[model samples]
Each structure stands twice: as C-alpha cells, then as structure tokens.
Target: MSLPPDIADLLAPKYGLDPSICTGPGLVAATRLRMEINGLDDEFSYYDQLRQSGEELDAFVEELLIPESWFFRDRVPFDFLKSWVTESWLPTAKPEVDVLRVLSLPCAAGQEPYSIAITLLEAGLRPEQFSILSGDLSPRFVEQAREGTYRSIAFRGEDYVEREKYFEDIGEGLIRVRSFVRNLVSFKSMNLVCAEDYADDGPFQLIFCRNVLIYFNDDARRMAFEGLERSLTDDGVLFAGHADAIFRINDDFGRYGPPGAFCYSRRAKSETEDVPDALPKPQSKPLPAIEKRRRFFQTSKVAELPKSKDPVRLPSADSLTEAKRLADSGQLEDAERICRERIDTGPASADACFLLGEILLARKEVADADAQFRRTVYLDKSHRDALFRLALLAEQRGDSREAGNWRRRAANRAQPSTSMTNSPST
Candidate 1:
C-alpha cells in the first residue's frame, strides 16, 4: 500500500513526477511491468537494470506520463491567442519586431501548438510574423508532434472549416497539418523542471501551458513556474488551465488581461503576495486525471485494442472490422454511426460499445468516452482494456484509491485475456 517508498523517491528527481501526480500504484504497477518485461524478478534487479539502461528509464517514464492533447483543447486559449495577437500584440508592436514568439509546454502530438498556428493564420498573422516553440516531457509525444498528423478527436470544436482550410485529409481518421502551419512550429523534447533543458533563447510573448502545472508537486510546480517566468518577457502572458488559478497558488504572477482568460503576467516586486494558510501544497492536490492516455496513432505494436467481453446478436464480423477501419482511417462519424446501430439492435453488444467508446475518445469527447468504456465493462466484466483505460483515467484525476482498485482489476483480467494482448490500452 505504501508503494515502495524507495521507487517513489527515485522517480521524483529523475522525471520530476510527484507520487501524487503519477499516483503511487500506477508507478509501482508500471515499474513491475517494466521489470517483468526485462526479465528481472526482484525490485532490486529492476533497480539495477534501470541504472544500467537509459532506455529502461525512458520506458518507465513513458508509462507514467499521459500525453493526452487535442487541437484547440478547451477552445478558449486559442481564442485568447487570437485576441492577444490581433489586439494587443499587433497593435502596440513595431512593424520591425521579430517573430511574435510563443511556447506550448507539454504539446501532446502537436495539437495545441498547431492550433495556435491555425489561430494566428486565421487572424492574418503571416507565417513569418510568429514562431511557436513546443516542448513535452515525452520523447514519443515530441516525435509525434513533429509528424503533424492527427485525428477527429484532435478537433475539439465540431466545425471542420479550419480543418478544411488548414489540414489535408490523409485517409482513414488521420488529418495532416498543412505545410504553412507545420512550418511555424519548432518541436523539442524537454522536461519542465530541468532548467538546464530549457531553451536559452526564450522570452516568449505568450505561453500556453494549460493542465500541466496541476500535475506537478509544489516543488516541481515552483520549478516549472520559475522556468516559465524566466522564459517569458515581463509582459509575457501565461495561459493556464482554469482549474489551477495562478493567483491562488503563487503570488509571484498577477492576473493579466480578461478575468476568465486563465492568463497571468509576472508581478512586479511590489505586487508579490503570500498564499493563504489553508491552501495545501500543490503536490498534495494534484489535479484529477481527466487527461488523455498517450495514444500512438495506430502504428505501435499495441495499437489494436481489446475486443468486448461477450456479445449477443452482435453486428456482422465484417461490419465490426469495417468500423475499426473507419475509426482508424479517420471517418469517425461513420464509425460512430455503425457502432451505435449495432448497439441499438443488440443491447448486449459489448464490442459495439467498446468500438463506440474508442471513437468518442478519438473525437476528444472524454466524458462520453468514459461512459462508453464503463458501459463496455458493465456488459462484459472481464473487459481488460476498458478496465485499464478507466484505471488510467482514474489515476490521472488524483483518485489514487480508485486508480489502484481499477489497476488491480485490470491486472487480474489480463492473465485470461491473452488473445487481446495487442489491443489498445496506451
């Protein structure tokens, strides 16, 4: 239950993760899996392997880090960028100014940074007028972002006008960002807490780091905030998630611009204030894990997720296969319709619900996706992939006990579900 304190302490310094952020059991479970995969039986052996193998450590960090991201995720921040650039940035700036620099931390699969490009372009900012520096802790995520490929799930708002204007459909469910947008970003793999890893060439006018601070412990939070502060110009604005109010957490930054912008500007020396006595350390209050799992766009060995438990009067096998293809190919709506029709006709179609759940998730409708995954589980108690997804979601959201409970159930379910091993989880 205590989750091997040694491992907990070991990870914080290396990866800058709080036990509360990864949640104790996910780290332990992942570590155990890492050990077993590497042929190490004991924790000591695994620890030794970790010291000898940088790859192993990378693999471990990959498991614990959730790289969920979407284009225009939450929508408001992109709108804020558009407003700031057109109104404040463009108006008061000199025509001879360098590219209006911006940063997107934890830019999962390039969505946020790409979205920023789209917003600026839509607002008539020429490609040469702005530059986006995108970074993420996960090398896998950084690589994916550089690829510039995405799916319907990455498109948060239903409107496809932007997609049509800025992206080229690459078949199935994949969308590739156009060259103009892709050219605007410079992607790098960097950790937030490692000040050394930060680009010395910063002072970005705006930084979009939504939902990242809430994942850090207080020390790590301070480190990350300090890094951001150092990276920004005095007038630079930080666009954070609404849930983690900067003023409430740290007084070094003051509210900037609109009240609901979730934006902050560095405070002058005289403006510094103290935190309330009642507010707990951020490490103790890590945000709930509504974050998406690191989904590798269908190329990995683990891409094909599990099949449903048991089904009655299910859709034709061909139809289900077609549905998978549709979802994978990027025809999410068609895939959803087919899955729903199957479920409506066959109420106990766990496979249909499972398929639908994956589609919803791909569309970035997380709460709906969560519901569908739960439905798949209810219909088929032994649905390991669904259980694991739920478990990961629970863990990320700060419900450590629930996360552990679901994880245990998932582990138990795994032994018997060998046939679905290559099916989706991460």
Candidate 2:
C-alpha cells in the first residue's frame, strides 16, 4: 500500500505528517478499513489515498491544526490585548449586557485561552462579566484543556512562577489549574475551518488566532480569514503570528503599529485611502555606521572588500577588532553600537551587516535579524556567515526547506575557496 511519490510531495508541503505513519504495520488494518468504507479501488490514485484512508487523513489534519504555544507565548501581544480590553473593549460594552465573550479557536491544549482568562481576571473582570470559549479539533487536546493539567517542562521562564501560582499539584508530574481561571473558560471540540457549529457563538470582540495560519496554503488561509471575518464583530481585533501579515493576503484588514509585529487592526475607511497603491517605498538613508560595526563583531567575520575610502572613518580593522574585544569582554550593546556606526558610513560593508544580524538575533529581534541577514547576503553572496545565520533563522521559523537551500549555498561557496588552495596551478 505504498503511496505514489507525487502524491506524497503534494501532501508534504501542506502538512508535515510523517508518511511512514501510513506505511507502518500498525496502521495497515485501519487503512484498509478506511479505504473499504469509502469504496476506494486498490488501484486508486494519490487523491484517492487521501479520500479513502481515515487514519492517514486524521494524521494529516492533526498536523495542520496543532500549534506550539505556551502561557504568555509572546508578552507584547498579550500586553496589547490586556490594554485594549481594559481601555477600549470593556468601556464600550453596554452595562446591561454583563457577559463578555472571548473565543480562542484552536486553543491547542488551553494555554492561550487560560492566558486570556488570567488577563481578564487581573483586569478586574468578574467571573460572570467574562467567558472564554476554547476549542480545538483534537479530542485529546480538548480533554487536556478541560483537565487544565500541565507538566513542569511545559512551563518556561516567567511561566514557571505563573504555573506555580495558578495550578495546584495533582500528583504524577501534573498540575491542575486553579478554580478561578478554570471557571472562566469552557472547552469544546471544534474544527475552525468548518465554522457552522460555532455560529451561535459568533461576533467575538477579540480573536486570538496567533501562530496558526503559517500551516495553511493560500486558499486555506483565505478561507480562514473569511471565517474570522464572519465570526468577528465590526470593531473586533484579530491577533496573528508575529511573522504573519494579512496585508498581502486580505484587503479587509489593515496594519497598525511599527512594521513586522503582531499589532494590526481592521481596515478603517480613511486608512485604506492612505495605503499606497504600490509597494512601500524603500528607506532613503543607509542604516547607521555604528549599527554596522555592531553587526560585524557579532558575526566575527569581515566582509571581503575594498575598504571604505573615508579617512576619518574609525580605523576600519581596529574598529572591528576592538568591537570583538568588547563583545568578548561582555559589552554586547557597546559592540552592537560600534557595528551600526560602521554601516552608516558606507552601504557596501557586508561584514557590518552580518554582525548586526547576529546581535539582533541574539537579542531575539528575529525579524530585524532576518532583514540584516538578507542585506548581508545581497551585498556579498559569498558571505558564509550570513548564509549560515539565515539558514538557522529559517529553521527556527519552521521552514526547513529554505534552511536546507541556504545551507547548501553556503557549503558550495565554502568549497571553492578550499579547493583553490590545494591546486598546483596557483
């Protein structure tokens, strides 16, 4: 019952479900039962495999639906959510209408919805004033959400303290959520891609759909957007992944705050007129020279180059060498500043760009780091350090294919330099 290669390829991109799960011995009986139920022929094509095999299809669906989330996964988005609820949404609510509904679709084992509940509770919303509707396609996750149990390993950083405060020891390395937060949320099994079942719960004021859309293809993304649009109130706010943007995907939404962050709002009539009909114009000035120097030391590689012609420029080699010295001496911010200053003086310095990317990546400014890496590569394709860093960033973002491509390019470029040294002709 081996699947055709083309079918596997098509399915692979959409869902990271391991194909071996289907070919495995344990699933054979289940697979056969599924095929028979759907009246699929033995000689059926790849699409038929998807239609016929319930077990395999379930595995695929699970991949698309699961998301990695933790309590307060990204603080900024939660902070904004808290502020908006306290200052905006709550004030606007009619006093006569006591129930404030919040829905976390695909709640993914309950961390997000619980986080929302905690925020509301902290904001002084009484138990009756607010309600959390948490849903997911996985019955297992839904059950876990109901139990509100978590292992110590699932709690990280500040979450460790929060977990201890909000949960009671239930034995066996599990902790049960306290009554206060638990009472705020109601768990249900839901498939967000199919929204009819939840139509009665419509028009949420705020929807936390973060980090879920990255799994979907364009059409699925569109469908999800439409579903959200239908489910949201007119002034409702939707929060998506830090890296995700609706600007390119949907005209119905508008971006807010600085670029490349989770802050966005529903498109306003006046805002729509302000959006340029074309791509945003590029920035006029080069990044600061100090920032370039900061970036250079972070990577610890000098771009191969004709050095800058400016005589007043900080001693080029010494500047980088000193920046590295400062970095090793535990002066990270200082080293970064030096790199930035170096880049501002001249745009051709890929060394500065690579260093800046490294510093930014270290600081957890991933999007900014990614931009610096792109700049480094654009300036010098042979920049191995930039290529390596870009590969690492891509891998972190769950894009292994892009990671592999960058790694291969780096390896190929590194090879030629090594090969030339061993040649006798030189």
Give me the candidate number with maximum TM-score.
1
CA displacement after TM-score superposition, residue 362 of candidate 2 (Å): 4.4
Q: For candidate 2, lDDT tens digit of each residue in 77-133?
A: 667666666765566555556466677888888988988888777666778777778
Write one digit per residue (lDDT tens) for candidate 1, span 59-98.
Answer: 8778766566777776655666677677656665555655
Model 1, global lDDT: 0.66
Q: What is the C-alpha RMSD of each candidate to the true structure, in Å?
A: 16.8, 14.7
Clashes of each: 13, 25
Per-candidate TM-score against the hidden true structure:
0.61, 0.59
What's model 1's lDDT at 57?
A: 75
